[model samples]
Target: MATDFWASTHYKRWIVDRATLRQARADDLLYIDDPEHLAFLAIYFAEVVGKLGKKLRLPQRAIATATVFFRRFYLKNSYCETDPFIVIAACCYVAAKAEECPAHIKNVVSDARQIFCHEPYNIKHFPSDNSKLAEMEFYLVDDLECDLTVFHPYRTLLALCKSGNGSEDASAQEEEAGEVGAGIPADDGPRYWGTGQGQLELPPNGLQTAWFIVNDTYRSELCLLYPPHLIAIAALYLTCVFHPATHETVSAVLAASSSAPASSSASTTPDPPPRRSSRQAAERKKPAQDPLEFLAELNVSLPLIATIAQEIISMYTLWDRYKEDSGSVATPDSSRNGEDDGPVVTPALLTVVLMKMREARLLEIAHPSSGRPVAVNKMLERTQAAG
Candidate 1:
């Protein structure tokens, strides 16, 4: 795989537009009701993968990569056609390999079986058969088209924060706390690099907050819609809006925005202007600038970044609602057939997927010719025993 993100298959083949994404979601609606349901299930699946990774003591990047793998797999295949729980389990195994943290298939299956013990139907989801997980691995790999390298925003954000201009040098701090003004020379600010001191640097926690924000963005389509660096910029922009120490920076930038639109667009850079000839373009292409200067010159859309921030924000809001409304407690003995009759504290997304899995398993048992479905005979024996 090409290590360069710009030239990678992720950027060229996987980064998709919204309308196309909407159509894909529509196709998956056989199992999911609407866009809201799809997003809710995505959040649940991410949590499942994360919790599994945490239990295994895997790094957060590994968990994040597994989550991305799960999402990418569903983008191509319907969740109903295949068992999401199994796919999620397989993703953790494959992601462990992809991230240089190999996990044995048996251990992965064992962890998942214990993790999802509260599965509604008790259909023995996350089967212990190592072969099942190994077989699912093939499907996951094929559906993902063997593109495993995920470019995240974490490194990009770190690079921006470490730059001298991006963060103020120690010597400049003593000049003035927050009242100093630095002006652009005749040719500086958005096209020209400025040596002045007025540029804003993020607070101590700004980088950390931006990192979390980028992590949360994976719950949505931001990873597939925008490049990693732009997502980092959006996180930084949101940090400026929310973090008390960085408020003044956003205020200053907004105040500056009234005069020109440069800073607002820093989060979403536009393409370079067209050139007459390849030779002329090669000759005129400017040398890369430091991160700060690049930020200043970027032609990003302020509104687009704002929209991305809002998407992350909305996911959190939904998360809170799901937790509050569902109480989010799991019970192994809870009724498996349908809703719990009363206030319905169980999350609908979880409920829906569980029901679908239960139904698919029943269909397989009723029609046993369907190539060794997860324990059809055992499930039938249970029904006979219960009856």
Candidate 2:
């Protein structure tokens, strides 16, 4: 991991242009008739990867990084060109190592096979051999250009909490709530709340919701669009707009935690406050500014932050409608459901992918000579057998 994000490989190479990303995705769009379905497929694959990582007891950092790896891989190479499951497995294997909590190739393969063995997806017998996983790992690394370190918003959120900007007063919050109307606008753009500037404090409930929004932002292109700290600010800002709470909530919670240790059975004893050090007293004497005040001072654009927040909101909206089988209407918590929410990985989709892979393989094998395309039924049979 680079000490300076601006000087790191993530900043130098991975932050891609929108047009460039769009052009790269064009290849995948060609094969996938319904682009929306393909997006759902990517989301499904990310969920599986996350689950696989968790079952192995890896940290959320590793899982989140692995999910980003999977998304980045598909961005460069289409699902039809390579197997999604193998790529997912490889990403998990590499991300575990990258995040300093390594998982062996054998463990990755076995755990993955065990997890998805009876799942709805066509994956019955995935790559169990360590050698196979290692090979796919090489491909994943190459696709990401060996940029393994990913800067997540987890640390940024923690920094905000420590800075005291993670909680806000009720009067300040209510005013914000009234201005924005809702978190995001019903139309395409974001509605600017009074002067489009404020102290930018998030209450405990708002902070928690912001944390959820940050997690959900991983499912969108915001990670690629902006820096980690900016994303954190955006999530908190959106939380305050959509669901505003007061700083007293967090203060009360902290007070409860501190007071709980003194009393037996934790009854309301109105625990006495502890004596503060001179340094602590001095620190408190200074005025507290917005935790994200530094962000405002920097060259960061408020409009860009708002746009990133809007995009994440849009992704959640799509996620609600992503489930084809359930036909459930989208609620705010729709994404909290299990993997069965979206469209299942149909054999037909796999078959199409298999046919494309076969064609590419044939082209590689018969470089000097021409050969006819393989039959669909035989190709499907071969794909199933390989799995």
Top candidate by lDDT: 1
**Alpha-carbon lDDT, every model:** 0.62, 0.61
Clashing residue pairs in candidate 2 are: 166-202, 167-202, 168-247
lDDT of 1: 0.62
Q: Candidate 2: misplaced stretches above 4 Å?
A: 163-201, 246-299, 324-387
Per-residue C-alpha lDDT of model 2 across residues 44-98, encoded as one tens digit per residue: 6656777788888877667778888887876666555456777778888898887
Q: Any idea what lDDT model 2 has?
A: 0.61
> What would the per-residue lDDT of candidate 1 be over residues 259-289, giving only the tens digit for each residue?
5666556658776776679769878885322
Against the correct fold, how does model 1 do in TM-score? 0.67
What is the lDDT, from 0 to 100, of the residue 198 in candidate 2?
A: 40
